[model samples]
Target: MNDEKIVQRAIEGDDTAFLNLIQLYKIDLYKTGYSFLKNEEDVLEAIQEVTYRAYKNIRNVREASYFKTWLIRIMINYCNDQLKKKNRVVLGEEVLNFQGSADNYFAMEIQEAMLTLDDRSREILTLKYFHDLKIKDIADSMKRPEGTVKTWLNKALKSLREKLEEKGGKVNV
Candidate 1:
């Protein structure tokens, strides 16, 4: 069955269908969590929490077709909460391993710039660029108009560019 059908079954409290939906989007959830938490342990915790939250509130899903986006938003919100609680960046071995790379400097700059952005701007940029989501998908997930999303994306890119330029010469993030 297609995702929407599976989502519908899950909403109807079908255990197998719910598990299938989680399995289908597990990687996306992991990547989304990892992008924010930047720690495997934290990502795993986030996954568990998101699963519970999704299950508890599955009935609140407004559109079955946008289940992936809804799931991702849950992960993002959980990750953000964890970040707020921690209130500091924790470097993992994954980042340490890249310390010797030539492009690491630029990568670090981009990360720093991303951190400076407001939450909504950062979210729009992440969903648009990192997740490669379409404008319509992001707008639907954010419950904002497409034009508003596009405007936010544009402003985010401009802010990111300015931050990168401040760090060094003009460079694309």
Candidate 2:
């Protein structure tokens, strides 16, 4: 079934359709959660919370076509809330260790740099680059104006560039 139809069915209280929708987007949601969270356990917890919240509030999603974005927004919010509850910032070492891959030096540097950004900046960058979301969709998911999203995107890129440069990595801003 098409995503829109599946979402519609989910909104109409079809349990199987809801499970299907979650299965379709599980990897994306997990990756999004991992981007902010420190450990696999935390990421899994965040995903569980997001799933529960999405299931309960599926009816609030106004557009079937935007179900993915809506689901991601919920995941992001839940991850943020978890972070706040922990009241601890994850160090770069911990984040890097979580991946446990030493083969990609460049990716490691980029991930380290991303860890330096504030939550909003990192979120904008993640949505734009990792999720490959359009500006309009990002703005909608973030509940911000397009112009503001643009500004934040630019600032995030600039900050990422500076951090990369500081670590002797070259990236075009």
Scanning candidate 2 in windows of ten residues, the lowest lDDT window is 91-100
User: What TM-score, to 2 decimals, does candidate 2 have?
Assistant: 0.85
> In model 2, how large is the Cα lDDT of residue 126?
84
Which digits, one per residue and each the tens of the lDDT, describe model 1 over residues 72-156? 8899888778877888765656667775665886766677677777778878888888788999999989988999999999999
Which runs in model 1 stand beyond 4 Å of their true positions? none
State which candidate has the highest lDDT: 1
Task: For residues 86-111, write the lDDT of model 2, one tens digit per residue.
Answer: 77766435544556565556677777
lDDT of each: 0.86, 0.85
Return the top candidate by TM-score.
1
